[model samples]
Target: MKLKMSIVDAFADKLFKGNQAAVIVLERWLDEKLMQDIAAENNLSETAFLVKEKNDIFNIRWFSPLCEIDFCGHATLASAFILFKENEALTSIKFYAKAVGNFEVYKKDDGLIQMNFPKREPVKVQEFPNELLEGLSIKPKEIYKNVQAYFAVYEKEEDVLNIEYKSELLKKLAPYDVVVTSASKNREYDFVSRYFWPASGGKEDPVTGSIHAGLTPFWANKLNKNILVALQASKRTGVLFCELKEDRVLISGKAVQYLEGNISV
Candidate 1:
């Protein structure tokens, strides 16, 4: 079958500067194994698949090269962008996704898309595994565990920028994904972070909006702030405007379309 696909760079003001996601539109659900194969073939951070459910509603799923992820923010943005471009006449769209315990995507009036995601509260863990730190040059100040992944706190912002480690060791130690975050003393940003997910797929994800659901609240409580600016310090960095609401976290960013084409398989 031939499928229409596009690559979107989410959280980017320009092309080639953010997380790249492959989006595909399907008439019906493909076999789970085929989806995995397609994701592996794409070899991108995340490949999003969607099918029309109604006039405005669509079903979405995200997969990495290695495994199916519960949620992926950048890919969702990519999917929305594709829909907007393809169906230019349609101003609004809704997506019912299996990610993040069943979530919805809304296309906004101002070209900005919003996703209502689940709140993943993190619990403080006593310590991190020795192997997890052995490969890295520095140590995290604290460690916390969430349902999706774990957060590793660092002491300095410079440390976050200059992080260099062995991906193989991190993959071995971490069960899922590991987030390296630090309080930014810099006046520019409230926090700086890097996400490493050797197990689930990408070695270093450029910008992770879903992880912020846990991170925004954790830092808000620690620093006693309601709204803050966050930076993801991967090779392709991003600036996220985040707010900690009573029950849910709101993550906002800009996305750009990188490529649009068709794929045959």
Candidate 2:
């Protein structure tokens, strides 16, 4: 079968800046193994497969090169980008995921896509795992853990940038990734962060929107503010506008189309 595939750079105004997610719009659900193979073939951080459920609703799933994940923010934005571009009349779209539940994406007047995601507020963990500390070259001032990943709080943005990960050790922290972050030195941004998921996705993620769901609330409480700007300090960087609500986090960014073609499977 021939399937339509598009690569979109999410959280970036231009191509090759943000995380690239491969999005495929499917009319029906394909076999799980086939979808996994497709995602592995794409070899991106995340590949999104979606099937339209209604006029404005879609059921979506995300997969990394290694396995299917419960949630992925960039791929969802990329999918919304494709849907918006295809139908100008569409101002918003609702996406349902099996484990993550429902999320809504709206097109702003400024051309940014705003995603309403559940707040994943992390709590301080009293005991720091030895493997987690051993996996990183730098020691964190504080550490927090949630369902998804570990949050490593650093003293400065420079520390976050200078981190060298021991991928082998990180692999020991399977099923959970690590996020190292600190207050941004740059005046334009409120905080800076880098994500590492050697055990799950890759050694490093260019720009991650899903983690920001937890990061936003964590920083907001620490900084004593509700709205903030975050910059992911990966080689291919990206910026995100985050707002912390009572039970949800609003992540907003722009996505640009990188490639579009047909995939034969």
Candidate 3:
């Protein structure tokens, strides 16, 4: 079967600046293993597959090279970007992820795609994992946990930037990943962060929008701001404009399309 595929750099102003996600929208859902194989072939962090359930509404799923993800923000942004570009009349789109429930994505006047996601505020972990302490070069003072990842709080942005990781050590903490973050030194942005998910097949994600659901609430409470700007301090850096509302987090970023073609499945 011939399927359409496109690669988009999400949370990026230009190509090669943000995390890349493979997007495929179809009339029906493909077999689970086939989708996984396709994602593995793509070799990106996340590949998003969708089927239009109704007008401006689609059922979506995300997969990493190794396994399916519970929630993925960048790929969702890419999906919205593709759908918006495909039809100019679509001002907004709603997605239903069986794993994480439903959310909405809409285009703003500034050309940024804004996603409304659940606010996942991580609480302090009572028992810290030994692997977390050994996996990083710098030990964080406190750690927190939410639905997806463990939050490692740092004192300085440089700590988050310069810290090295042992994949094997972090891999031991399976079922949950890690995000190291700190208040940004650059006054232009409120906070800085880096995502590492050795267990789920990604290492140093370029820009993770899903993790920001937790990160935004964490930082917003700490920094005492409802709205903030975030910088993902990876080699291919990207920025996120964030806002925290009642029980929700609004994350907006720009996505640039890099490649489009057809693939046989």
- Give candidate 3 misplaced runs (Cα > 4 Å): none
The regions of model 1 sitting more than 4 angstroms off are 54-56, 88-92, 107-111
lDDT by residue for model 3 (1-265), tens? 9999999999999989999999999999899999999999999999999998866579999999999998999999999999999999988999898766788999999999999999999999978899998999999988999988899999988899999998899999889999999999998999999999999967888899999999999999998999999999999999999999989999999999999999998
Against the reference, the lDDT scores of all candidates come to 0.81, 0.93, 0.93
The TM-scores, one per candidate, come to 0.91, 0.98, 0.98
Candidate 1 per-residue lDDT over residues 25-98, each given as its tens digit: 88899999999999999999999998887564788899999988887888877787778778777655666765
Ranked candidates, highest TM-score first:
2, 3, 1
List candidate 2 stretches off by more than 4 Å: none
Cα lDDT tens digits for candidate 2, 181-214: 9999788999999999988888899999999999
TM-score of 2: 0.98
